[model samples]
Target chain A: MHAIQQQYWAVRDYLSPVLKESKFKEHGRITPEEFVAAGDFLTYKFPVWTWEKGDPSKARDYLPADKQYLVTRGVPCLRRATSLAYTDADEDAERLLSFGDGSAAGGEAEDWVETHAGRQSNADSAANPGSIDDIPDLDGDGAHEDEGLSSAVGNLSLSGAKVPDTPHLDDIPDMEEDLEDDDDAAAAPSKAAPSSNTVIDGSEIEVANGNLLQVRTYDVMITYDKYYQTPRTWLLGYDENRTPLIPAQIFQDVSADHAFKTVTIETFPHSGTLQAASVHPCKHASVMKKLIERMNAGVVEEQKAQRKSGSKDAKKKWMFRRASGNGKDDKPLPDDEDVEGMRVDFYLVVFLKFIASIVPTIEVDSTTAF
Target chain B: MPVVQFTQFSSLVQPTFWHELTRLKLEVLKLSDASVPLTAHYSAGRTIKDRNTGQEVALGCNFTVGSESFDEKHSLPPFAVVAKGIVKNYNTIDEFKNADKRALFSQAADEIWDSIEKDHDASALNRFLLITFADLKKYKYYYWFAFPALVAHPLWDIEDDWKEAKEQFTDKQLLSLHGHLEASTTPYFLVRPAVAGDGVDIAPVEDYTSFFANVPTDSQTIGFFDPSPHPSSPGWPLRNLLAYLRAVHPTTTSTLRVLCWRDTEPAHESGQWKSRFGVLTGGPAEGKPSAVGWEKNPQGKLGARAADLAPMMDPTRLADQAV
Candidate 1:
């Protein structure tokens, strides 16, 4: 066995006796199965809960051996169960049910263990119950809401039990669908359902009861817009010779004076036991190059139109006054003339640089998920 | 001694005629001495009698140098010795003798030499001789008749001496002379020559004669008749000199002293009888100088009191007081 697994069992073994003694003292009688169950729950919850004395539900004094056993074995088991529920998809459903059971146990065993041990351990039993309650509620929601809540709680619960579940090979397609739906919802809100939103690849095995079961597997599905899929051809050179591959439209308004044109390169995907060579080929570079050329032509055309309009507006301003002359002469004096100077708006340059830097990221498909 | 009696006449004589008569008296004094008392008699001719009354009126007068009494031995020498010296040098006898041959010379000599002697003396004579010769050389053709014939000649030199002596006489004589000719002439005297300084020539005699000729003969002489009795009436030339001195020596009291004048009659009471004359005393003994008072005649008419002469004397000072 691996060291992590051996360490897990050692804690479990040490806690079995304390859980048995605590259950017996608190309920006046307790079976080994109930003791094991309580011990596992406490191990999942570890360090967040401890046994105490004089709990209203318990009848006997808590003993030192029982207290030490609970701390050494039951707390670690409860912590392991919580961490496994977060990171291992196979354990998620079991942990959800166990969390409900743990919340129902209150501090009866903890009180019994502390009284028999003749020690005071006032670990927050109230705080542990709150986390226990949070686990079961997460499962009843839709996949999108559940994933969001899970990720959010995953970060909040830095303790072992609250880690997020890793994607399984069989479950990857569903997760991909959920992520795609979330991205779409975040983006256009009113767009049609995404088409390339699922992944399918996993093996099923028959168990001893002849029930069909799936082995643990992992798959990562990535989705991106046309920009990120074909980024190489979108690599544009700036005045400073810095090349950016992002779609300029992603970062800047196409109608603005400093707007840029863009293209998409290639999309990337990662999966368990899958080599990059097996991935399907796409005309990403050619598409990106064509899109970039088209966008560049459009930008040139817009610039010409802007120049023509600007020159015409300037002519109008020079020939006429904006305000009423109120019967005074509207024309400038014969000797009075304006000399035009060359000017370039630096704000436009800075804005273009910012767009270039960010657009390259949007154009390149460096990650598997959208 | 013979006593000569004569009747007085009613008609007033012209002041020039009186002046000429006095000049004749001085001439007689020059021809005589202290031991001989000089006397003169005048018979009013028909013209004079007709202007007055048809009666024949005769007048006699006598003049002596000093008294024969020892008690008054220190008195001034009689006019005779003084006048003899004057006449010896200034006499027009040669011209009078050859009157027809040199009529212009004789007439010129009489008007120039005689007038100078009657108004100047020895020191003034020397100054006059030197200055007149310079002025003649400077203004030869312009002052043709007067400068050479009267001022530059030897006779004119002596006559200038007597004229100087007359100016040194007491203020009584000076004032009397001023009044004596005030009506028929504007009385003028020769001031000390150096009073005008080295380079300046005496004022032209023609200017004085012309000024005298234009004096209003009908106007009354309204000032003191005795020079010693009061102040000398400053003639136009002396007044002009005093004005120049006042301008140049404004801070000096001695220069200003010559400008003082006194009126015999106070301004409020005198009316037309007022008399105005220059006071020979330096200034008022105490307090501020008071302006001389007299009757003013704008039209040059006798007895016309149209304005007061006090205002004319120093209008600026009166104005200051009024303010």
Candidate 2:
């Protein structure tokens, strides 16, 4: 397996249970096949790869006519190379030997020699032509070509093809240049073009992240005019079996651009005058009426008592006396009076009495309403 | 009938003596019957001239008159009536006997005798009659004095009571009244009772008397007369009526004035009437004439006017003067 693929498996295995508890089930199931599929899908949708140079392979020259088609298709190209070192001559010689019909005698002879000598051979067989195996045929139909093919197959088995440390984009020179250029551009404007050969634009990725997925996500760029802006993306992950898990990195992204617009609700204002309108007007009027009525009744009773005496003159005289007595011992009279010795005339008194009767009621109504 | 006699003669005498005599007559009447006869005689006398100035002058002589009456079968001698006078210049008794001389002597004697008779008659009248007359006069005078006092006293009393009542009224009644008027009823004009210490404008003494006196015959001023002899005796019932009126029509100005009077202090001594009437003290801006001697009461203002009449009159001073 590729090292990257191996690392991915190891991390997934370690984080799977944690991810499940954290509710990121979909991410937990991202196997190599799924990863590759996702990458291919991305590539197809936004292709960034292009031919970088003409095909360069030595295997094509020696291919037979029928096999020549493979070379033309660039299937025989050596996409990766890896270094290997030799430790002992026998292993080296074995690696350098060509595959043939049976080599038991040679293997025995080599073993006998090594046993008699009591030491291992120090020969550099990888560089020696003598280490090459002679061709042998199994059917003995006098088919030399088959003998050579078997020998070639044996050689191929002896040496393994090396894998490259970095994946190369053979068909996409523009993408390579874009990737190189993005390092510098990324520092200045995160929202700038990813690269000339970028498979996906930032806006497309944002739309996908926000709408297409079950757990919506988005990259928000909070801007101060156009000069100052913060770029951030939040990945809201969800799974069929679990709640979504937002990665810490995405949380950091959201927080960095926290000054974004958000939705809110609206409200009103409270005041006394506004509230007063709802009160019952009659309540105040009723209170006023009661007060005035009581007062009027009291006044009437007093007047009746006065009238019954039939001595308004004498009473007035006494009142005068008492009043002149420095108000020392006299009791107070009721609010109203008869016409006999009153300072005002009868008509005025009547008018005033009527007014007094009504005044309290009105005042009461006003206050109550207020 | 027993006759009481009096002798009269022409001479200069003190008016005080006449007054004393009149008093004596009245005292006598208090103790005696009216039909009792009293007699009086006047005697004529000769006057003597100064010897150094011997211009012939009539000689002076004192004479006496005597009255006689039989007490049984025996005759009683008459008592002489005597008098002294300045002699005239006539040379003879014949000259003194002329018409002018006789007329002068008779007239002097008659004048003295008539005065004596009148005094005796006055002394014989009924005691009750005299007492009643004196009392009536005193009462009349007091009526004048008490008019302001009566008016002021009750007014002061009512004023004070109303003051306290007013506070209560404002606290309890007025507020309610205001509320009622504002709410259920149309507000009537406000009527405030006169406050104690709010100066009243009493009429000046002259103006007060004149105002009543000058009132046209057809005017109601004459209506003030009380046909009932003792008007003040039935004071309480009248007061009750006034009080009732006050309550029923608290906004009545007339009733308020009456109440103000009922609540005020009485005027006792002289000058105190001014203070009591609030005329000397002044009163609210009601534009009414003062009840006492009007001098534009300095304390005049709104509401009732209270004056320390006790201080103005100073009963102690009157008492001292009486002593």
**How far off is each candidate at the interface, as Cα RMSD in Å?**
79.9, 77.1
Per-residue C-alpha lDDT of model 1 across residues A1-370, encoded as one tens digit per residue: 1234425643653454423232222222223333333333433322222332211222122232222122110000001111112224333233211223232222122222111111111221112211111222344657887787656545433222321211111311111111111111111111112232111111111122243211110111111112222111112111000101012111121111112112111111111111110111143334334434443444444334434444322222111221122223343322323311111111111212332333321211111110
Off by over 4 Å in 1: A1-370, B1-85, B89-323
Taking the tens digit of each residue's C-alpha lDDT, what string does model 2 give over A20-139? 111112111222222223233322222221111111231122222122110000001000010112246434334222333243222332221211111222221112102112234344
Quote each prediction's TM-score: 0.13, 0.10
| Interface RMSD, prediction 2 | 77.1
TM-score of chain A of each: 0.15, 0.12
Global lDDT for candidate 2?
Answer: 0.20
Q: Give the Cα-based TM-score of candidate 1 against the true structure.
A: 0.13
